[model samples]
Target: MTALHDKAKGKVNPVVAVGVEVDDAGNLDDVVLYRQQAPHTYKQVKYTVDSRSPLDTSYLTGPSKNGGPSILRKVADAWVALTRDGAPVELALVTNRASSPADQLLAGRDARTMLLMPAAAEQTRRSERGRLRATWAQATNLTEPQLLMLLNVLQFDTARDLRHLEETTSLLMLVNGLRGDHQAVRSGADWVAEQARYGHRKIDLEMIETAVRDQELRTGPARSVLSVATLKPDPLKTQAVHVLDWVDRFDGDDAFSKRRPRAPFTWQQLQADVEDIPHHLGAVPQVALTGSLRQATAFLIGATLRMVTNVDLAVTQRGQLWESAADYDQATHPILAEHSLGIGEDLALAVEVATPMTDDVLVFLRTQQVPVDRLVVLQPPRGAKDNAISTPAAAVALTVGLRDQARRSAKGHPRIHLFLAGPMGLSLLLGHRWNRVAPTTVYEEIRHSVQYEAAFTINA
Candidate 1:
C-alpha cells in the first residue's frame, strides 16, 4: 500500500513501512519504508514500517518482512510487552483481525475512484492558462489606458469572452490614438489663430466653443462667453450653461481673432540664442578659469544677464512638472514651461528658464529617470553678486549629495554632475564634468541676460 493510504488506515506494518509516526489518538499518521533493503532471497523478511497518527501517537515497526503472519506476530509481541492485567493503555503496536489484507486492498481500490471522475483535469488546465495571461499582462508594459478601455467596454457587454474583449479594446485604443495634452490644445488653438491670420473665413466652431466655455468656467464669463443660458428666472440662478456665440462669428485665423498666435520665438531663434552666448562674452578674461568653473561661469553669466534685463520672463512653480506644457502656460506664463519627458527619460531643458524657486531646477532634473551629467542653473546677473557661489564648496557639495541621496533612497541610481555658479563663481566649480570651457564673451552676457535659460546639454 502507498504511504498515504497506510497513514490513512492507521495501520503501521513493519514489513511494509520504512518510517512511521503516530498521533495523540495512538493511530498511525505517516510512514516511509525500506522498499528493497532486504536481499532478494529474503525480501519480505527485511521490510520496515513507520507511521504517525492524528492523535500524536508514533509507531515504528522494525524490519520484519517474513510475511503477514510475521508482522502480526511482532505486533502481538509488542502489545504483550506494553499491556498487562487488562490495563488497556495505548502505547505499543497492536493487531486485530479487522486490520487484515482485505482492508488494505479495499483502500487501494477506492483511491482511483475520484481520479476517474470527469472534467477535473480540464478545469485545472483552464485555470493555469488564465493565471499565465494575468501574469504576462502585469509583467509586460501594458498601458493604463488600454486597461481602462478594456474595463469600460466590459462594463456593458453580452460577449464577455477574453479574446474578443482584448481585440475590441485594442481597436478602440487605435481609433482614439491617445488624447492631446492641454499644451496640444493650446498649440492647436494658436495654430488656428495663425490660420485665422490669413483672413480665412473658415473657423473650427466646435473648438472655439469648447475653448470659450472652458475659459469662461475658469475666468469670469464676460471675458469669454456672450451670455449665460439660465433655466431659472430668479437672480439666484444655479443651473446655467456658458454660451460662446461670438466664437463662430470669427472668420479669420490671425492673431487678432485667435486666442494664442504662433510662439513669439521659433526653434531656430532659440537655438541661435543658445549659441550666441560665447560670442557676446568677448575674449577678455574676467578671471582665470578652467573645467566646471569655466562652464558654470559661462552658464551663470548668460543666465544672470537675461534674468535681470528680460521683463517678459515667466516663472513657473515647482508643481508645473506634473502638468502638461499647455496647462503650464495657462497656470503661469512667460517664465517657465513644463511637460512630461516620458518613461526612462529625464526632463529636458527644452527652454532655458528660471523657475519660481531656487531648487526647483535641480529638483525637476533629478526627478527624471535618465542620468544627469551636470546641473547648471543660469540666472540673470544681479548687482548683489547675481551669481554668488556658497563657497568652501560645502553648499554645492551638499546640494549634489542630497540629490544623489534622494535618488538612492528611492532605489533609482543615477550619477549627476552638479555646479553652483553665481556672479562670483568660476567654471572650475563644475569639476571634471564640464565639457566646454570656452573663453567668456559678450554673447554670454546677452544670453545670460534672460532669466529663462538653463545651461546644460539635453542628451548629456
Candidate 2:
C-alpha cells in the first residue's frame, strides 16, 4: 500500500496519512481521508474473489486448502471486530464471484440466514464445531452466545457474473500484482511452502470502487449517493462546451444557423462573448485561496477564467522568478492597447501577499492588452515578517486589509479584477472573505502559455 502511494503521480488524490489506518489484516482494503468529498472520514473495505466456477453454497462454507475459515466469514468477523472497536467506518465487502440462486449475496439482517443454512450451521455441528475451534477460535473467539452478533454484523457485498461484469480480476494476477505489500496484512500464512513469504501490496479498495462508480455515472445506473460524492459540476467544463459550440457556429456547423455574414457573432467573438457572462459562472457563490498548494490555486484559476474574464495581471518584483517572467514577457509580449469598455473603473487589484510579485503579473497582463484603471496592492504588516502570513489571525487580517483596499479602490464599481500572488492557503481564505463582495473576478498565472487568459470567475 505504501509502495502504491509512492508510485502515484500527478494530480491523483493521494491518501491522507491521518484517518486512513487499516485493520489488523489488510488485503485489498480501503481507508482514505483527503478526497474533495468526505475529507478526514474513515472507511474500511474487505475483498473476496472467486474465479473458478459459479458458487453453490459451499464456496461460502468450504475452507481454503489448509482448512482455515473462508475469506467471507473472516471478513465478516473483521467487521464485527471493527464495530466493537468503536472505529467509525463505512465498511464494504468487494468480491468477484457469481453465486447461484441457491447462494445469494444478502445484506444486513437479511444475511443472517446464510449462517443457519446447511453450509454453515449444520456443517458447524457436522464437524462438531472442531473446525471453528481450529480456525476461527483465535480470530473471532466464536462462542455460542456471540453467534447472533456475528451474523448481524457480517454483511458481505458480492460481485456476481464475473465473465460479464467487465471489471472482474483474475485471482492470480491480482495476487501477483500485489507482490511486495506485506505491511497491511500480518495474520495470514503463505499456503505455498507453509512458510514462503508472500503478500501483495494493496491500495484502498474505495479507489477502485470510486472509479467504477464514476464509470457507472457516465454510462448508466449511477447510485445517487456515490455520484454525489464523486462528481462536482465544473464551470470550465461547461464553458468549454460553450466554447466548442462557438467554434462550431463559426464554422457553420450548427444545424440551426446557416452560414451568413449577418450573424450577431463570429469566431473571433468567442473569447469576447464568453468573457461577458459573469454572474452565470462558478458553481460556488464564493471562491477561496487559503491553501499553500499550487494545484488548488491553479484549479480555481482555470475554472474561473472559463466563466468570466479578460485579466490585467501584475507580477510584483520578487527576485529571480519574477525577473524571469518579466524578462520573458518583454521578449515575447510587447504591450498592446487595453480594450476600451467605456464603463465603470476598470479596476486592477494587486496581490503582494507571501512575496512581492504584482509587477510581474502586471507586465504579463500588459502583453495580453488588458487594461487596469486602479491598482489595489495587498501587503502584510510593516515589520512583521517574511512572505508567510504567520498565523490564521494574520491571514484573516490580510484578507480584511485586501477587502478594504478593494472597496476603496473600486469606489462604487460593480466589478473589480483581483490578481493573487500569495500562499495558496491565504488565497483560498481571501476568496472566502470576498464571497460577500460579489463580482470580484480572480486571475491566475498560466505559467507557460504564451498569452495570458482569464482563469475563472471568482464571485464565489
Candidate 3:
C-alpha cells in the first residue's frame, strides 16, 4: 500500500543527512537535515511518471541544483523530528560550493563547546535562532543545532576577543546545571569545606580564596609577609590532633620530646643541589646563604631537589651556574639581561611547594586568561643554600610576578598573595628573628607562625 501510494503520488526515494544533538545529561537528539518538502512534490511526481522501479536514469527529481524544495523538505522533516523529541532545533542555510548543499552543511561541530550554556546562548543570539536558555546561564543540555550555531559564533571576528570563552562557558554551564533557584549559584561551600578538612584542595576554593586574599598580598613593601591560608574545620583539626596525640601517646613523650634535632647539612647544601640541576632548568647556583632564613631555606631547596630529582647534593654544586653572585659579576650582568629567572617545566612541576616568579610566566598566564588566586611566593635563593639565609628577595620576586599576571588576566578579578616559602624562607620573608632550624621543623614553625602573628591577619 505504501509503495502504491508512492507510485500514484509520483514520489521517489530521498537522500538523508543526519545531525546528532545532546543535552547536559548526554542524551542524543539527531535531526535529519535533508527531507522532501511539499513544493518538491511535483519533481517527485515527474520522477515517478518517467521512471520504473528497477530502471532509473533519474528516479527521484531531487531538489534543484541550488537546493530547491526537496532539500528544504528534508531539513523540515528533521526539524520536526527534533521538535517532537523536545530538542532545540533551528532552520538556516549553510554555504557549500564544493559538495552537495546538504553535505556542505555541518552535521555537528566540536561537541565540547556545545555542552556549555554560554556558548549555546551566544550561538542563538548570533544566528537569530530560537532561545534554548531562558537566561544567560540557563541551558542544562544542548541540541545539535544549538551547538553548531555556537561554533559558528565563535568563528566570528566579534566573539574571538572573548578570552577563555571555552573555560568560562563551561564553568557557567556547570553552575547553571547545579543552580537550584533562578537567583544564585548554588553553594558547594559545605562540600568544599569538608574537602579542606580532609586535606584535599580544590581549584575553585583556591580561586575564591585567592580572590579574597589578593588585597592582602599586594600591599607591597609595607606588608612584607602576606599569608593566604585556607582554614580547615574543627573536626579535621580534631582528627589531626587525635593522630598527633596517638603518636605521642604511643611514644609516651611530652611536647618537647617531639622536637627535632638540628639538620646535619648546612646552607652549603643549597649550592650543591642548584648546581646539579641545569641552569636552563632554572636551578639555583651558589647562594650567598645568610640571614635567619638560611637553615630552613637550604633544607627545603635541597630536600625538594633530592625529592623531585635524584641528583646527589655533590652533583648539584658542579653546575657552572652554581657560582656565587659576587664572583660571577660579569656572567651575572650578561645573564641578568634576560630580565627574568624563568624556570623549566621540570622545576615548576618539581617545586610545586613554592612557585617561581618570572615576568614571562606572569605574562604567559595572563595571555592564557588564567584567574588570579592568592599570591604564590616563588623566590630563588640568592645566597649559598648551606650558609647564607634570610631575606625577602624570593617573596618580592614572587609577588611581582603574581601581580603582573593578575593585572594581565583581567583588570579586576581580584588578586591573591601566596607567600610560598621554606620554613626559614618564610621567616626571612616575615622579617622575624628566629634560630636556624631543620626544614621540617621550619615548616611546622612557619605554619604556626602565620597563625599566631597578629600582623598576618588582615582587616577583612
Candidate 4:
C-alpha cells in the first residue's frame, strides 16, 4: 500500500506512532496505532514472524495466535488509548503478514471459529449459576459471517524479517553501495556504534512501501487501510469487538474468571473488530443486522467487490423514506433505476412495516413498470409507535405480517425486489426470515438534502 501510494506522498496517511513495547512490560509482539488522518479511530496491528513459512488463517483465528486470549492485552492497550483521551472511540484491526491469501483468512468456511452464545434470551426465569442463566445474549452460535462482520480483520503482505530489522547486514550495504564498495557491514557495534545511530531510526511509509513493492511482498488482494475504513456507520459496533476481545482474554485469566464485566461489556472489542472489514470485502457487511432489528429497516450494504461472493444489500424502514405512492416522481425513480438490481424482476415488495418509505418505492416500481402489485407494500397499523420495533415483540409481529404478505405475493413473483425503511433491529429480524426465501434484492437510499445521490443496490 505504501508503494502504491508512494507517488502521492501526502495522500498516504502515515501511522501516527508504532510501539515496539508495552505500557510497562517487555517488548510487545503487537502494535497499536491510529491513522494520521482519522484520529480517535484506532486499530491494533499485530505481526507474526513466520520465517519464510506459508501463513494461513490459523495465525488469526488460532487458539495460540491472534484468535486466542493473547489479543486481549493488545486490545486493552488500544482501549486505554481510545478512552484515555475521551475521543469518539472507534476500533479496527489490521494484521500484516506475508505468504497468506486474504480470501482464505477471511472467507474460508473451514477456518470459522464457533463462538459460544447462550441458547436462550433475557427475561427468562433462569438460575444465577445453577441453570447456566438463560440471558446468554439474544444470539445463537457465533457464525463465520457474524464473526467476520464483527472481527473485520484486514491482512496485508508484510514479512516479519522486513518489518523487524531489514537484515542488519544490509545496515552497511546501503552505505557500501553508496560508496561503490559493495561490501556488507562486518559487525553491528564493531564498525560504528555511533554510525548506526545516524540513520537507524529513519523510517517512513514511503520507504516501507518502496521496499515492499521491490521485494514483491504484497500478495493476495491489495487494498489500502483507508479502503477498509471509509464507511464506518456505527462506532458502537467497533467498541463491541474490543469488549469481546477483553472478555476472550478475561475468560482465560484467573483474576476475572468468576466475575463478568458490566454493561457495554464486550462491546468495545466488538466495535473494533467489525467496523473496517466490510470496505475491503463486501461479503461480511456493515455488521450483520442481528437481534430484533428489522433487517429491512436500515439497509445492509455489503461491498465485496474483490471477493468472489459479496452480498450487496440494503434495508429501509416503513416511514424512513416515503409516505404513500404519491412520493414517487421522475427524480426519485431514477435513483431506483440506477440501483437496477432487480430491474427486470418478477416481484417487488415494499417493506412498509419497517418504515413508511414503501409507498414511494412502490410507486417508483410501478412507474417503471417493474412488476409491483397492490400487495407489494407491507405495513403495520396506521398508528404504531414511531419506535415501536424497539421491542422483540413488535419486531416479531411485523415479521409475522411480512411472512403472510410475502407468501401471498410470492405465489406469482419469482424474484424479490425490496425497498424498505425501518429500524436496525427490524432489519436484522428481516435478515433471518430470508434464509429460505427467494432471491431478494434490496435498496439503500443515500439521500441528499431533498433528494438522493444514488440508489445503492443492496444484495439480499
Highest-scoring model, lDDT? 2
Candidate 4 global TM-score: 0.30
What lDDT does candidate 2 reach at residue 352? 61
TM-score of each: 0.17, 0.32, 0.16, 0.30
- Put down candidate 3 lDDT per residue, 247-303, tens digits, no spaces: 111111333332222245322333343334343233322111211122233333333
Supply candidate 4's per-residue lDDT for 212: 44
Query: lDDT score of model 3?
Result: 0.25
* lDDT per residue (tens digit) for residues 415-442 in model 2: 7666666655445445434534546556
- What are the lDDT figures for the candidates, one per model? 0.26, 0.37, 0.25, 0.35
Model 3 misplaced regions, further than 4 Å: 1-302, 306-440, 444-460
lDDT of 1 by residue, 31-80 (tens): 22322233101101121232212110011122224433232233333333
* Model 2 global lDDT (CA atoms, 0 to 1): 0.37
Q: Which 10-residue window of candidate 3 scores lowest in summed lDDT?
A: 220-229
lDDT of 4 at 62: 31
Count of backbone collisions within predicted model 3: 41
Q: Provide backbone clash counts, one per model.
A: 86, 37, 41, 60
